[model samples]
Target: MDRSAPPSPVSSYSARRGLFPENEPFAHGWLSTEGPHEIYYEECGAPSGKPCVILHGGPGGAINPTMRRFFDPAKWRMALFDQRGCGRSRPNASLEDNTTWTLIEDIERLRVHLGVEKWTVFGGSWGSTLALAYAIKHPDRVEALVLRGVFLLTEPELKWFYQGGAAMLFPDAWERFCAPIPPEERGDMMGAYHRRLTGADRKVQAEAAAAWSQWEGDTISIRGPEARPAKFNEIDFAVAFARIECHFFMNGGFFPEENWILNNIEAIRRIPGWIVQGRFDVVTPLASAWALKSAWPEAQFDIVWDAGHASTEPGIVDALVRATDEALRL
Candidate 1:
């Protein structure tokens, strides 16, 4: 297989289900969420329409310009922001006071600042994790939820990807992912990598950061081989990404308890949730998604057989676009 080529999408989705035409944000600005860090936010589509906040995945990934196309510009208002140490947010990659709880509050502050009474929330992967946490804590403010690649961030799920479970399926990539650490350090991959990712050694940090980011790409690329994709554009971005991700994973996402979302399902039971997951996602597997759906039986679930962990997967894009359309009825 040509590892260099992009994966062929496996889907029966029609062109009609594709993302809406390219649309620029109507307004964009940075909101001061904490002492020195400002959450970078932008509003797209109709300013007065049903607002839906889109949380970009990664404790590090920023919202792409085209992401707003998932919603109908005429009927939906899209609000997107880069959490703590990511995107255009200042003090980039500094983990000062960054936590899952802080992100949840940032969402609320953004909503309050925008004066949106209640709005739909959409997220994928880590974004899904934050969305659920926010909704669970402030259910009254969430009109609905559209989640993709549900990630509960449980101990089991973390081990699956970091320790060995996901490694079994992608041994080649796993081999590379484990290559950076010493034999003794393999037992604690996150801690081992976190050490280098945050160390004072610039060379060590960049190496670990590149390896960490490539490992993620390999696991999510449904059609690619286990190989380092490419050098990250900047060492700063890579370090921040690897550092923040490892930070959250190391701290169990800063949750007060494990399975917090599942334990507090009652809060969002009537909040009208929609779950879209890829059958083959290695990062946040179907098991996590299924568990979430089981805990919140009222949320509609869609399993995209042809997709993988990436929210940009073709089948996933179709499902997400339609999911946004469904929100119009609410």
Candidate 2:
């Protein structure tokens, strides 16, 4: 299939500097978590340009240079980093220093490290969750938000993604993911999968990781195809996937019950924000996005018909670019 091409400037920059931009690459480095771990990140664009921080999904997924496309190199400086154990962050899959709260703190540390008073924020999927969490916690530090594939991290959202509605769409993948354990053990997915996927058996671990990732890929591109799907190999699959999933599950996605952000909307509403969601998004369903719009009708919410969880989705990407442009105006 011929995927829709991105904006000409986007494609041009991608070819020159990577998927992000060639204007100027941020010096490569790490920020002390001021704890056991250090967060790794890259910056680009002009130092004097308005700050627009980009957050990548996956507690374990690292930010890509491609993310730089959301902002104009001359107008906005971009900061991209790996959260805690994900991406360039030290000690991959180290449960000792990974969690939602730890990530929130890391963002704070990042802002301080960068010496930015406030900046527009951009994120998708899990990144969206982090953006919202950060915005609520420190609304003063957020200039605006460019959110795509909004993951609210509610129980319904979690259950659907894990073993409920979304699972029904991928029976084959679900069956494979669940096949390792017996019917009785099925109730304890975390325990059973953790034991087997992390066990010494290489075959057992690979199968589990593949099954887990297949479902995620399918959901990420609900309406169509994602240009870049995560590549999960046998060695990195089991431990990484298991760690992220089990962490979210055990901690209830690092947030409380449904409408966790509802009560706090009034606080962040004063800040300009955009909600870009796919109409058929199985990962972070459009329903939640709609609810968010209902709470803050003034918020810019675009329901892109031809997209899904992946930010690279044509419509989703365009919406983000537009959002960033609009935020700059405000």
lDDT (CA) per prediction: 0.84, 0.73
Give the best candidate by lDDT.
1
Clashing pairs in 2: 19-66, 20-65, 26-43
Q: By summed lDDT, which 10 consecutive residues of candidate 2 come out lowest?
A: 11-20
lDDT score at residue 162, model 1, on the 0-100 scale: 90
Best by TM-score: 1
lDDT of 1 by residue, 85-108 (tens): 997887788888999988888998
Model 1 TM-score (2 dp):
0.93
C-alpha lDDT (0 to 100) for residue 111 of candidate 1: 93
lDDT of 2 at 260: 73
